[model samples]
Target: MKKKKISLGDWIFNIFLGLFFTLFTLICIYPFYYLIINTISANDISANGQIMFLPKGIHFQNYIDVFKIPDLASAALVSLGRTVLGTIGAVLGAAYLGFMFTQQKMWARKFWYRFTIITMYFNAGLIPWYITMRNLHLTNNFLAYILPAIVQPFNIILVKTYMESISPALQEAAEIDGASVMKVFMKIMLPLAKPIMATIAIFAAVGQWNSFQDTLILMTKPALYTLQFLLYQYINQASSLAAMIKNGTVISTSSLATMQTPTSIRMTVSVVVILPILLVYPFFQKYFVKGIMIGSVKG
Candidate 1:
């Protein structure tokens, strides 16, 4: 069959939509591109804000300076450990809860779901949360970061949506074969829901990896600082260190002198901190897209 010819109005509308989306995409990506360029550029050029789309001069000194900072590597390891454990726990717990809520016979399911939903909008204020954490002896503990955010309501909601989309015939078949609810969930549903699980896992992983506020509030020891908290301290305190060096209070050798260029150092730290998430995202992109499309269609 011959294809229908495109009309002038359709062509005009398509051109307008393309230009609008292209402009939106550029606006979204320019900042990250600028950041990557500025991070590798010399600090002198970055400080002047002249490095926009490209670096004025190439430099790896910022990365070397970041390495020189004491406890950087150790703090990164601590953050990595916390992120891995917390993300796993969150994904598993949320998935189980989602599966449970998907069952028609689950008692008080509406009330429980409402309770979880309420948490999404309403939170106990910082002071009350801090007091509770202190009372529970979670302060200064790694659990302080991991436990509080383990079962986010948004993730639970996503999992529940995905789980509900599974055909009821599957569960009925499992039950007919003498499988209990737990066995059915573990053996059948969980395996089939890998796409949604992976999507949720990526979200949980990125959130935990970038978390800094919880560590700042719950952890007092410098040794327990997450990558983000360490970077925050570095950014906030670097100027004071630079001033000390200028006043001769702190001696600045060639290695130590690089501390003064924290503009580039901060950018480099951001790039480094975000690199893992960037690398992991492409692996999950297909799963994420599938999960979203499935949920949207089913809904």
Candidate 2:
């Protein structure tokens, strides 16, 4: 086949589209880049807004100081623990319920499915929610994070739709053999539903990793503090310390390179908290769009 020549209008349109997207991409990326450069630059220079577009007075000491902060390791562990455990629980629960809902013989299936989906549209109010958590004795409990997220209705819907698009013959064949329901789910549906499951897992993991509101309302123990909540505390403390150092009321024990300021603390903590999710995201990104599209095909 001969190549078609591009028209002037088409070329102009393509150029405009490319420029628009480039500007949009830069807009999205620049804020994170700004935060990183600010954190790595000298406190005085960064405070003066001298560093932009590129870092000045490059140093890794802000990260070092952030690592040295009290309970940071523990808080990170809490965040990681909740994210991993909660994501696993959510994926499994949603997968099982989604598969079950697709079964024609399931008792009161429509009612239960409708009941679950109703939650997405309604809230019982914050006070009632807090009281419910307290009543369940989940306050200051790690289960608070895992249990509540395990049965997310939206995840179940996605998984259900995705599974519905799979060949029912595969499931029926398994049932015709000596395979049990659990075995069929494990050996057949679950493996086939990997894409959508990965999508749900990513959703659950990000939500779990970023969540701090539950920690604020449900936790009283420092030991259970999440990385995000601790970052909030660090920002407040760093502000006070920055003010004190400025007024000459406190002397710096660390060198100029490792000094902590509110801006540095805030940006460093944000990077620390955000980096893991960012790193994990690309691995699941391949399945993400495919999963959402296939899962939305039914309804």
Best by lDDT: 2
Candidate 2's displacement at residue 21, Å, is 4.5
**lDDT for 35 (candidate 2):** 90
RMSD of 2: 2.8
> For every candidate structure, what is the RMSD over all alpha carbons to the true structure, in angstroms?
3.6, 2.8
Q: lDDT tens digits, residues 1-299, model 1?
A: 99999999999999999999999999997877888888777665676788887776676777776777789888889889888898888888888988898988999999998898789899889999999999999998988877876788887888888888889899999899999999999999889888888888888888889989988888889888888888887788768755665688755353342344556656777887888898889988999999767655542
Off by over 4 Å in 1: 1-29, 241-259, 296-299
Clashing pairs in 2: none
Question: TM-score for all predictions?
Answer: 0.84, 0.88
lDDT of 1 at 281: 92
- Predicted model with the maximum TM-score: 2
Consecutive 10-residue window with the lowest summed lDDT within model 2: 250-259
Residue 22, model 1: Cα distance from true site in angstroms: 7.0
